[model samples]
Every structure is written in structure tokens, then in C-alpha cells.
Target chain A: MKRKHKRLTFVGLALLLLATAAALTLSAFEESIVFFQSPTDIVTKSVSPNKRYRLGGLVEEGSVRKKDDAVVTFRITDMANTVNVSYRGILPDLFREGQGVVTEGFFVSDVFTADEVLAKHDENYMPPEVADALKKSGKWNEMSSKMKKQGHVLGGGSQ
Target chain B: MLHRFANPTRFLRIASIAQPWIAWATILLAGTGLYLGLFNSPADYQQGESVRIMYVHVPAAWMAMFCYTSMAIAAGIGLIWKHPLADIAAKATAPVGACFTFLALFTGSLWGKPMWGTWWVWDARLTSMLVLLFLYLGYIALINAFDDPARGTKSSSILVLVGLINVPIIKFSVDWWNTLHQPASVLRMDGPSIDESMLWPLLLMALAFKTYYIWVLLVRIRAEIISNKIRILRLRQVHG
Candidate 1:
């Protein structure tokens, strides 16, 4: 082979090896790499209560209940299953009913007792006027249903 | 055909002509993009004014990945074909890519504080992007570590090629894992979810960033060529 062809083979071989190594490493750490588990994932896996993990899903509409001293309780749902979460302290500015969220804690009895709660916003972005117009035209519900059909993974998840 | 522009004199001539046009394009695109982003575009229904940060943050993030990919490709060409200009091009791209990565992280943090309620997280998307920033920095540091410039170039080119793996990982992190960061809005199988008004500023800003990279790369490559000449002259004088 020419010197250039020889160098090409070497680089190509190196890249192939590196890719294989990365694939193996990422697969090995797949479980840990997932930042949060959806309510459905939790239900199907029946995860142990002894371990702490992040629970993520949409905050179910009309499920938020504020208690005294900055404690709030809500239900996180994947549209297929729901998990009750109780969080203390302040919620993020983006936290709201019908919005995506992730709470970090372990299950206390049946409820998820969260120490850290984060809002996970979706990719959709539209002006307030457009949103209002969509609502007025009754297209908002259609769009929302379309999103639901796509899956309630929030930011695309392993599920 | 690949080495048609391998001659430094010919390359310099072309770069000199293209540089001013790229510089002006950057200024014009950036000015219009800022205007549209800050004023013309309406506030997001949910994020409100904070959504404007996307114009800067998203473009910077795109440019960061773009630069790294381009750098890796140039480095690979330099390694396989022994192209001096390719090596210079890869070297010139490093600091610019690093700056874009830093801007993405900084703007992301600012945006995150109000939206996500945190400055940072260890989520897969965010973590992989952070790793990209480190890879750029590591490549820069490695290239400068050796006294012998040729050795530095060879080693750093290998490093750049190896680091190319992170680009794909970063892009798919949100999809492969549950991340706090949202998935792609623009470069998705489905068309961009963003409204047309919001998307215009984003595209303009991304174009502006691309032109800025080209303008800077040309200047850096010219400087590198001159410096190489100076080094050669000094070595010849001393040896003679």
C-alpha cells in the first residue's frame, strides 16, 4: 500500500476500535446514565425502595396541593401510570400543573419523598398570541393529543 | 484534487479575498438576528422573555458541535494525507470551538437558572456537552505541551479524531437517556416545533456564528503560515 493508504487504514482501524469501546462502556452504564425514570418504568420494574432515584413525568393537572411551610404534594404521571410525589422547599419557576418535572428521592411507603424537584420543559415554543389563537380555534387540544400520542417521555427518554 | 489548494500561496490569496466578505456577513447577520430575537419575536407563552436566550444559546451550541466535527475532519485529513494546511486549519479551529462551547454552557446556565431552577445538572445531555468542552480544552493543551511543533501536531490530531466520538454522544444523549435538557427542536426527524418567528432568529444567529468561524479561521491560518516561515528562516540562519 502507498504511505497515504497505510495511514488511512491505521486511522480507520483506530476509530473502529474506539467506537466499539465507547459502545461497550455506554451500554454498561446505561441504567445509571438515565437521569430519571418515568412512572411507567417504575411500575414495570417495581424498583426497590432502598435506593434513591429520580422520578420524572408530567405533573398531573389538578393534582397539586400546597401544604403549610413550603411543602407541596402532586402526582407525576406518564399518562399510563401515576406516582405521588411530596416535595418540600421551593419549586422551580417553570413548575406548574400539566408540565414535565423530575423529583429526586426514594419512596416513603407509597409516596415519593423528594428533596430536589426540577422542571423539565418540553421542546415546543410558541408566542403567547399563537398559543391563545390555538386555544381559541380549539387546535390546542388537538396538538396536545398529538403530543400525547407521540408518548409522554417529555424530553425523549429510553422508554 | 484534494491537494489543489495545498499550496500556501494560492490558499492565502483565496483566503484574503474571502475574509472581508465573511466578516461583513457575520456583522450583518448578528445585528439582524439580535434585533429579531430581542424585539421582533414574541415572548414564549411559558418561558416569557427567557426564551430569547435560545437565540444565542442554541446557535452557540450548534457552532460548538460544528467546529468540533470540522476540526476532527481536518485533523484526520492532515494525519492521513500529511496536509500542512489541514493541520493549520485544525489548530486554528480549537480556540474558536472552545469559546463557542463556553458560551453555550454560560448562556445555558443563565437560562437554566430561571427555567430549570438550577445552574447545572449531571443529566446525560448537559454532562456530555460539558465533556465536549473538556475535550476541546484537552486538545488545545496537548497541542501546546510539546516543544516540537510537528510532534504536537501529530499527537493533537489523533486526540481530535478520538474526541469525535463525543459529538454523536452529545447529540443523542437526550434521546438515549432521561435528561433534564429537552430534545432537539430544530434538527429532528419531525420539523422544528418552534414557531416560525422564533426560528428565524435562531437560523440567522447560527449563520452569523458560522461566518464568524470562517473569518477567524482564515486569519489564524494566515498567521500560522507566516509563523512557520519565520521559524524556518530562524533555524536556517542559526544552522548556516
Candidate 2:
């Protein structure tokens, strides 16, 4: 009986300490916790400029600019609001105008200065993008109208 | 109250009855899941064929976290309530959870390279999940570190309790921190953001993984019980 009590006490103490440590660590890093924000989140929430973040949305059409070999500027949008993004690095091959993307960095004077850029989706298990495009142009109306009943836009075919 | 199942003979009898049923369910669910996931599912407007990786990758990721959470709970019960089968269940689950975590990380990387254009990133969701894999490895290693089986069980259970913090971190990482990984879509509060055509296969795959866990867990526990009998028999011969 005494041995059982001792074991229970030890287990109880360990759990309590673990809970305390986790709480402290979580509260200490509040800013680092906001992983990725939509453009509307940034505009509506008044995000601070100094904090690093991930900004994700559709890369705006006709907004991509290649000023130099490694430097690029573009705009990200959600069809509701848009945010300007600039980056100086080798862009991911999947990074293109008018696709979903995520950019990581801090804001610099109203511009999102991305340290890294990543495409939101990639071609792996699904059919190739070209096949999808071919299917879209041929049967877009029928497929989209079917999707419309479900109340959600088909991502790539939306625009 | 719980000592009713302390008898290995009784528990083994129950496990035998349940094992075959769980195994068959696993096969049936996986067959349907794969058919729906691979053949019937519509291609993602963005990801195309690469989106199919989610059928395997996401389910493995979910199982990795799930097994750890179950292990931690079993460890807590075994260590505190002194449940007989709980410790064996926890021990049996570690390797399976470790394997799932490894697959999740490997497949996630493979999918990432094609979609995100990088094989690796220090994103919170990915990194915390890596930490979970390490914790599973450490728990498995610690269990065998001691010459005394009871001592090893106690120490490993302690480690499992400490590592329980990682489970929540893994689940909320995409939401709590700036990560390259996308936020939750399937188990979201605002209903599933994924299209219904895609949601069916994902749910089926998740169910298949779950039934698979239950099937393997029973098999491992039975093995553990036999091993315990062997250990006891050897001790009796030495004493005699």
C-alpha cells in the first residue's frame, strides 16, 4: 500500500511539472505562434511589422515583376484583399502568377520581404497540371456547375 | 475493480475473439479507401496527381499523433492505476507509432519537393512532428535500457508522460506558429474546408489506419503476454 502511494506521488509530481513547463513555453512565444495569416487577417488585425510570419494566398495575376536575375516583386490576393510581396532569392519552380502560395518573412515598409517562397500545392499523387487544364477547358462549364451545387469554388478553375 | 483483467488468460481469450474481426475490418476499409482515394477522387485544381500523397501522408501523420496520445494515456493508466494489460499495450504501440511518424515525415518531404519546391523546412508543424518521432524512439530505447523489466517499464512510462506535451504541440503547430505547412482542413471548427469528393477518401483512409492500429495492437499485446510467461518460467527453473 505504501509503495503504491509513493509511485502515485511521483507520477503526479512529474505530470504537474510537465504541465507547468509547457504552459510557460507556450505563453513566452506568442508572436512566433501565429504561423500563417491571410491577407485579410493582416489588414484587419493590424499586424506588427517587426514580427516574422507566413503570408499565404493566391498569387495575383499580371502582378509578377522580375527586376533582376534573383529579385522579384508580386502581389498576393484572395479576391477580397491584396497585399504586396517582394523577395530576393531563387523562387520555387512551382511559384507562378495566379496560384496559391505561401511566403515567409517580415514586412519591410509596407512590403512583404520574403526570405522563402513556397507553392501551396504540388504535383505528386494527383494528375499533372496540364491534364487538369486540358480537362478544364474542355468540360469546365459542366464540372464547375456540378461543383457549384456543393457551394465551393474549384481552386485552380476559379479564376 | 480493474484486477478482473489482470489474468493474462482471460485477456488473451478476449483478444483472440476480437483480433480476426479487427483484421478483416482493416482489410475491407483499406481496400475501399484506396479505391476511392486513387480512382474515384477528383484531382485537386492545384495539386493534380500529387494531391494523392495526402491519402497516405496525412493519414500516417494523424496516426502518428494518435498512437502517441493513446500510448501516453495507457502509460498513465498502467503507472497510476496499475492496470495489467495497459503497460503491454503501451509498449506494443511504440514501434508502430514510430513507423507511422517516419512515413509521415518521409512522404511529406517527397510531396513537398514537388509542390512546395523544397524537401525540408524548419516550419513549426514539421519540426514538432519530428520531435514526436524522436520521443517515440527515446521511449522505445528507454524501455530496454534497464536489466530489470519493471524498472524499464517505470522509466519508460515516465518518459512517455513527459513527452505527452508534444502531442498537443503537433496538433496545433500549424495554427500556433508561422509554418509553411497548410492549416487544418479536415478537422476544422468551421467544418471541412476540403471538397466533399476529396473528403470521403480522406475519412476512409483515416478509418483504415485506425482499424490497422487496433489489429496490430492486439497482436503485440498477445506476444508480450507470451514473453512474460517465458520470463516467469525461466525464473522458476533458476529458483528450483
Candidate 3:
């Protein structure tokens, strides 16, 4: 082979090797790399209470209760299962009923004691006027149904 | 065909002609995009006025990845074909890509504070983007570390090729793993989930960022070519 062709072959082989290595490494660390686990994972896997992990899912509608102190209680659900979460600190600004949430803490007994809470917003973007109009026309359900068909439930729905 | 413009004189001539037009387009597009994103566009129903940050943040993120991909391709051509212009192009692209990466991170932090309740997170998407910025910085540092400029270009080209792996990783990080960062909205398998009212400003800003990169790239390439000429002239004078 010519010098140019030889160098091309060397680089091509190098890239292929590197890609395979990356793929393997990512797959191996897959469990740890995930930012949070859904309530379904915790329920089905029956994770031990000795270790701490993040629990993420939609905050169940009408489940938020604030006590006299800073403590707040809510239920996180992926529609298949629900985990009770008790948080003593302030929640993120975007935190609301039916919004996506991730809480990091320990699960002991039957409740999750959360030390931190982060809100996760959906990808949908629209003007408030449009949202208001949809609600007025009672077409909000139709819009949410469309989102469901696309495998995304923005708010107040099962995934 | 690539070799036709490999000559510095030809490259310079073409770049000179194209530079002013690109600069004007950048200015026009950025002005309109800013006006639409900041003033004309509607505030998001959920995020309120803060969603306007997406106009700048998303475009910066896209340009960061786009510039790195272009640099890697140019570096590859330089290595295999020994094209001097290609090497120069790759060298010129590093700092611009680094700046865009920084802008993305900075604007993202600003947007994340109120929205996500934190300035930064160790999620797959955010961490991969941070790695990209480091790759750019590492390339810049590696290129300048050598005493001989030719060796510098050769070694840095290899580094650029290696770092190309990070681009795809960054793009798919949100999907492959659970992340605090949201999944792709504009460039997903399904059409964009964003409404037309918000999508237009985003596209316009993205175009503006592209034109700005081309405008800066033309200037840097011209400077590199002129510097190379001066160096050759100095070498001849010393020998004579």
C-alpha cells in the first residue's frame, strides 16, 4: 500500500477500536451513570435500605402537604407504583403537583427521607395564552393525549 | 477538488470575498433573533420569562458541537492528505469552539439556577458537555506546547480525532441515561415538540451563531496564512 493508504488504514482501525472500547465502558457503568431511578425500579427491584439512591418520577396530583415547620410530604409515582417522600428543606421553584421530580435520600421503613429535591421540566413550550385557550376549549386533554402518543407525558399523566 | 483551494493565495482570495457578506449576515440575523427572542416572543407557560434564555443557550450548545465536528474533519484531512490549509483551518477553529462551549455552560448555569434549582449537576448530559469544553482546551494547549509548529499540528490533529468520540456521546447522553437535563426537543426523531412561536427564534439564533463562526474563521485563516508567508521570508533572509 502507498504511504497515504497505510496511514488511512491505521487511523480507521484506531477509531474503530476506540469506539468499541467506549461502547463497552459506557454499558458497564450504565447503572451508576443514570441520574435517578424511577419508583417502579425501586419497587420491583426491592432495593435494600442500607444504600442511598435518587428516586425520580412525577409528583402525584393533590399529594403535596406542608406542615407547620419546613417539612413537606408528597407521593412520587410512575403510575405503576408510588413511593412516599418526606422532605424537610425547600423545593425547587418549578416543583409543583403533577410535575417531574427527583429526590435524593435514604429509603427506610416504607418512606423515603429526602435531603435534596430537584425539579425536572418537560420539553414542551407554549405561550400562556395558548395554554389558557386550550383549557377554555377543554382541549387540554386532547393535547396531553397527543403528548402521550409521542411517549411523553408533560404533566398529570401516566408515562 | 480539495487541493484546488489548498493554495494559500486562492484560499485567501475566496475568504476575502466571503468575509464581509458573512459578517453582515451574522449581524442581521443576530439582531432579528434577539428582538424576537427577548421582546417579540411569548413567555413560556411554565418557565415564564426565563425560557427566553434558550434562544442563546441552545444555539451556543449547537455551535460548540458543530465547530468541534468541523475541526475534527479538517484535522483528519490535514493528517491524511498533508493539506496545509486544512491544518490551518483546524487550528483556527479551536478557540472559537472553546468560546462557544464556555457560552453554553455559562448560559446553561444561568438558566438552570431558577429552573432546575442548581447551578450544575453531575448528570450524563451536563457532564459530557463539560468534558467537551475540556477537550477543546486540551487541544489548544497541546498545539502550543511543541517547539516545532509542524510537530504541534501533527500531534494536535491526532488529539482532535480522538476527541471526536465525545461529540456523539454528548448528543445522546440525555437519552442513553436518566439525566436532569431534558431530552432532545429540536433535533429528535419526532419533529420538534416546541411550538412554532418559540421555534422560529431558536432557528434564527442558530443561523446567526453559524454565520458568526464563519466570519471569525475567515479572519483567523487569513492571519495564519500571512504569518506563514512572513516566516518563510525571514528564513530566506537568514540563509542568504
Q: How far is each candidate from the true structure, as Cα RMSD in Å?
A: 1.4, 6.3, 2.4
Identify the runs in model 3 with alpha carbons over 4 angstroms from their true place.
A136-139, A142-159
TM-score of each prediction: 0.97, 0.78, 0.95
lDDT for residue B156 in candidate 3, whole number 0-100: 97
Per-residue error for B10 in candidate 1, Å, reads 1.0
Who wins the TM-score comparison? 1
Q: Write the per-residue lDDT of candidate 2 for residues A1-159, one digit (tens) a residue.
A: 787788889888888888889979876875555445677777787768888877877688799999966789999876677889999988775687765688889988789999988886421222345446657688645643443333222122112
Q: Sorted by DockQ, highest first, which candidate order results?
A: 1, 3, 2
DockQ scores of all models, one per candidate: 0.80, 0.24, 0.54
Chain A of candidate 2 scores what in TM-score? 0.61
Candidate 3 structure quality by residue, lDDT tens digits, A5-110: 9889888899999999999999899888888888877888877788898988879999999999989999998777899999998788899887788899998789
Worst 10 residues of 1 chain B by lDDT: B1-10
Residue-level lDDT of model 1, residues B1-240, one tens digit each, is 767788898999999999999999999999999999998999999999999999999999999999999999999999999999999999999999999999999999999999998999999888989999999999999999999999999999999999999999999888887899988889988899899999999999999999999999999999999999999999999998
Identify the CAPRI category of the predicted complex in candidate 1: high
Would you list the C-alpha lDDT of every candidate in the order shown?
0.92, 0.80, 0.89
**Which candidate's DockQ is highest?**
1
